[model samples]
Target: MHKSRTNFVFGEGDKNASLLLIGEAPGAQEDLEGRPFVGRSGKLLDKILKAIDRDRFNDTYICNILKCRPPENRNPSLSEIDECKPYLNHQIKLINPKLIVTLGLVAASTLLGKDSSLKDMRNNIFYYMNYPVLVTYHPAFLLRSPSFKRNAWEDFKRIRDYIKD
Candidate 1:
């Protein structure tokens, strides 16, 4: 685990968090803060989670495919995710969460093992290693396109519904 990246931390809250959020990589704020989801996107994510009656800081196990932040927030290269996959896999095994939510294209692509548009990816739940995965637009995208908030909200509701079921 230590071999992965320096800016990595286990999710907050209970060690047995039921939800896991897998992201692409740490942003500048995440790298500097040594925490996942601390920047603008993180803030927006918090709101989404709150809307669904979940608290990211206390309910979801948040992580990235790559622990290290890519230069200038660039997308993580395939090799990087490959190198860091074991750590993520280990975390997933240890946490064994019931629901896994993937944020952004890179994380979703890595999890799904395919490249697809975010528009086509959302609106449905997929299975990976038997765990339910819900893919949604990254909060950064919502920041760029506020109109997508409705779609994001719909996804969040789906997550909430999954939890209920």
Candidate 2:
């Protein structure tokens, strides 16, 4: 997979941050730039962070479950997730964030190790490696279904409150 990928979009932001945001995978723009969350979804994510008084550059770390983009922006296969999880795990170990915000179903499921609907996961906090994890809609999903923005905002508020503690 790495052999076919243009670049490995590991992550970006404060290395010592106490907040970590995990997304599903990189998109075309992210792949091209060799960075995570640089496209439209990323732009919305920046807004979400700003609303919470957080920014990737200073207070939070951002990363994806898969280091590389899947073909056609498809959902990552179980095998692909299995292969890439260790890298994400290592990142968590290194960052040791006090709070983790999963940006989509894929991220929430992968980090939580459970298969469930996004609705089932949202508005709740789960534990991943003992770190508090909050599940929310992916920015891409919110872009497509603006109705869910309210829900996503609710999740972000939980994150903001958690970090404030």
Candidate 3:
């Protein structure tokens, strides 16, 4: 699906990290920079990680379910996701993370192979390829709905504690 794309936002951060964060897809800034989480949402994510003493460059790997940005930042279609699933699977295999955090519903659904609300998915643990998976709101969502930042912070704290263990 991304073969004809000009820029491909591949995975970043510590390749050897035991923690991995997966977002839905890249945005305009990420598409331009060929990196994931480089926009406003990216900035927020950085702060959230810093609060828990986990830096993307040092402690975790970050990527998205889709390599190419969907037009106008719309959600990725099912066919697009299907095409990109293998790449994400390969990334998970290579990173071999002990825990995986899925940001937002699209990512959680894609990774978990089911559709469910964020409320139903959060504050709990699931598994993907035997790796523990945690669901959380995307930074973009938190940006739009600042009211949920508290919940997101709680989730991040859990992630921090899990990593420490």
Q: How many backbone clashes does candidate 1 have?
A: 0
lDDT-better candidate, 1 vs 3: 3
**In model 3, which range of ten residues has the least summed lDDT?**
1-10
Evaluated against the true structure, the overall lDDT of model 1 is 0.81
Scored against the true structure, residue 69 in model 1 reaches a CA lDDT of 78
TM-score of 2: 0.96
For candidate 1, list the clashing residue pairs, or say none. none
lDDT, candidates in the order shown: 0.81, 0.90, 0.92
Runs off by more than 4 Å, candidate 1: 1-6, 9-13
Better of 1 and 2 by TM-score: 2
Clash counts for all predictions: 0, 0, 0
Which stretches of candidate 3 lie above 4 Å from their native place?
1-4
Residues 1-165 of candidate 1 have per-residue lDDT tens digits of 234445664344445778888888887788777888899998998888888887865657788887777776677777877988898888888888889999888888889886789899888788887899999988888899999999889888888888777
Residue 32, model 1: lDDT of 73
Residue-level lDDT tens digits of model 2 in 1-165:
666678899999998899999999999999999999999999999998899888889779999999998987788999999999999999999999989889888898889988899999877779998988988899999999999999888888888888888
